[model samples]
Target: MQENFEDQESVEIQVGSEENLKIFIVNKTLLREASNYCRRRFALELKYEEEPIILNGFEPLIFEIFLQWISNPAPRITYDPDRLPQEPWLSNAATAWLLGKKLQCSDEFDKYALSQFVQNCAFMTFGPWELIEKEATTGSLSRFSDHWVAWNYRLAGPGRNEYSGLRAARATLTAPVRDPRTFDIEHWYSDCGKYMRPRCLHDPITRLEKLEEAKRPKPIPPAEWGRSTELRRERPQ
Candidate 1:
C-alpha cells in the first residue's frame, strides 16, 4: 500500500518553503476519500500553477501525518514511552484534530480522529502527569488544553479554568472567539450537550478540586531578600 502511493506518484504535492522545499509524490486515489480540502486540491489542474499545492498554516510534519492517516485510518501509535518521543504523539494528534476542524471533515471521520486523539491523551497521562501538564499548559496546541483538563476532570480533576477551550470551540465555527483560554466546559455542556454529550463532562466530578496544586510551578518572588536584610540591619541589628 505504501509502495503504491510512492511508486505510482499520480499526484505531486509541493510542500515546505523555498529553502527546504519538499516534493511528495503521492496517489490521488488514497486522498480522494479522506478530506474535501484534499479532494478539491487534487481536483485542481496542477499544470497551470508554477508551484505545487502550497498549503499554508500547517507544519509539513503535521500535514504528512494527516496524509498518512488518510491513507490508513486510525494511526498506529506505539504507547511505549521509552520508545516513543515525549511530545510528538499528543501535539500531532492535536494538530490533526484542528486540521480536521479546519477542513470540516465528514462527521464520521472527524469523530474517529477525535476519539484517537482522546485515547492518545489517556495513554499519555499514565506515563507522566508532569509531561501531560507541561504540554497542556504550553497553549500552543489549539483546542487541546481544555480537553486535557477535561481528561483530568475524568481521571482526577483540576478546578480552575478547566473547560474553557472546549466551550470556546463549541461557541462558534467562525473566528474571533473571546479568550479561548478561559471558556469552561460547563458552558459547552449547556450549549452543545444535546448534540454531543461528551462523557468526561457528562459524568463529571462536581467538587472544586485542585488535583495537582502541589505539582503546579511556583512563581519566583521579586528581589526582596537583600533589601529586607539591609533594612533590618540599619534599624536594629
Candidate 2:
C-alpha cells in the first residue's frame, strides 16, 4: 500500500556534519511538496520516522533558510550580511541559490533565490566570484551564465575579470546583431541589455563600432518624405 505523507505531522531532519550538526523539525507534507530531494528520499524510505533524516553536505544556516521558506506561506528571506557570522550577504545568497538547485525546490523558491542573488550582485561591490566561476565552469550554474555576464558588465570588478573566458563565451553566444534603426532604449537598460551593449565582453574597436551604429539616425523613407512635402505645399498659410 502507498503511504500517505499527509498523515504525518512533522519529521526531523539532521543537517551538517557530526561535529556541528543541526536538527530541524518541519512539516512533512510541506517538505515533501517543496523539495524533490526530500520527497524522493521520503518516498523511498519505509521507516522514515524511526530515525532523523540525515542531510549531509549542507550548512545549518542554508538548511534553516530552506526550512523557513518551506514552512511559511510567505517567506521573508532577505540578504543581510549580519544575518550570518563571518559570511557576507552575497555568499549567503549564493549558497541559498545553490541549495535550491540541489534540492530541486519549487519554482517560486528558485525565482526568489535567483532574484536575491542577482540583486545582491547589483548592489554589492564584490561577491563570491570564485564560487560562481567554479559552479559555472562545472555546469552547476551554467544556465545562469547570462545573468552573471549581465551583472559583471555593470560592475566590471577586478575579481570577475579572472574568469573572462567563461563570460566571453556566454557574451558571444548571446550577443545580438547591432541595428541602430531597431534599437530599443528601454531594453538597453534591462539586464539582457548589458549583453546587447557595445561595452560587453568583446573587442574595444568592435564595441566602439556598435556604439556609433546605435548613435546613427535611421533615414526617412522616400515615400514618407514625398507625402510630407506634398502636405506642406497644399497647406494654407
Candidate 3:
C-alpha cells in the first residue's frame, strides 16, 4: 500500500519548553513514523495528509500545548482570527479536557493527557488534500487532528466563528442538498464511509438504507471495480 502512494523522504523535528514544539518540512514517511510514535506512546492515531507531493517539504509549524497554562496554570481558550469562521464542535475534546482538569475526572484526565501527548508529539496539526472541482478531498490514511479541533469548537458555541475542514467537507456534500434525490451514498461511502467507525451502523434501518446502495456489502465484487488504470494514469505526472 505504501508503494502505491508517494512516500515522504525526509523530516526535521524540534522540541521546546512547555509543549512549544515544532515540526518543519516533513514528508509522508516522517509523518507516518511520527504518528506511529504517538500511537505507541498514547494509543491514539495522529491524522495527517496522504499525498507525498502535497506534503513535500511542508513548512515547519509551531503548536502551543501549554499555552492555556502560561497564565491560568491550565489549558484556556485562545482564538486566532486567522483561523475562522469558527466551528463550534471543535471544542469538545479540549473542553472535556478542561473540565476534567478542573473536576479531576480520571477518564477526562486520561483524554487530556493523550491530547497533550499528541500535541507534544506534533506541535502543530495540519493536512494536505486533493482539490478537485473546487472541493477538498482528504486521504483515508491521513490523521486530521485540526479537523477534530474545528469540530470541538463548532460544538462549543455561537460565540466563536471557526470551521473544521472535516465538517466543511461534509457540508460541501450536504450544503446544496435541495432535492435529496440527487443524493448518492455509494459515492459517499467510497469517499468517506470507508474510514468510519463500525458502530455507525447501529441502526438497522439506517444500515438497510445505506445497504440499498449496493456498495455497502461486506466485500465488494471484483466486477464493481472501476477504471483504476485510467485513474492512475491521470494522477499528477
Total clashing pairs for each candidate? 4, 0, 33
* Cand. 2 TM to true fold: 0.54
Candidate 1 least-lDDT 10 residues: 176-185
TM-score quality measure for candidate 1? 0.45
Alpha carbon deviation, residue 194, candidate 2 (Å): 14
| Model 3 alpha-carbon drift over 4 Å, by segment | 1-136, 141-150, 164-237
**Looking at model 2, which ten-residue stretch has the lowest summed lDDT?**
179-188
lDDT of 1 by residue, 1-237 (tens): 012245564666655566555667667666567767767766575645534555555566766776766776763332232443344555566656566656646554555444445445544444333333444333223233443444444433344433334443332333222222222323322433333223333222312234355567899888657877788878953
The C-alpha lDDT values of all candidates are 0.48, 0.57, 0.32
Leading candidate by TM-score = 2
C-alpha lDDT (0 to 100) for residue 102 of candidate 3: 30
Show the colliding residue pairs in model 1: 163-184, 163-185, 164-183, 164-184
Candidate 1 residue spans exceeding 4 A from truth: 1-4, 7-9, 17-21, 44-51, 75-88, 122-191, 194-237
TM-score per prediction, in order, is 0.45, 0.54, 0.20
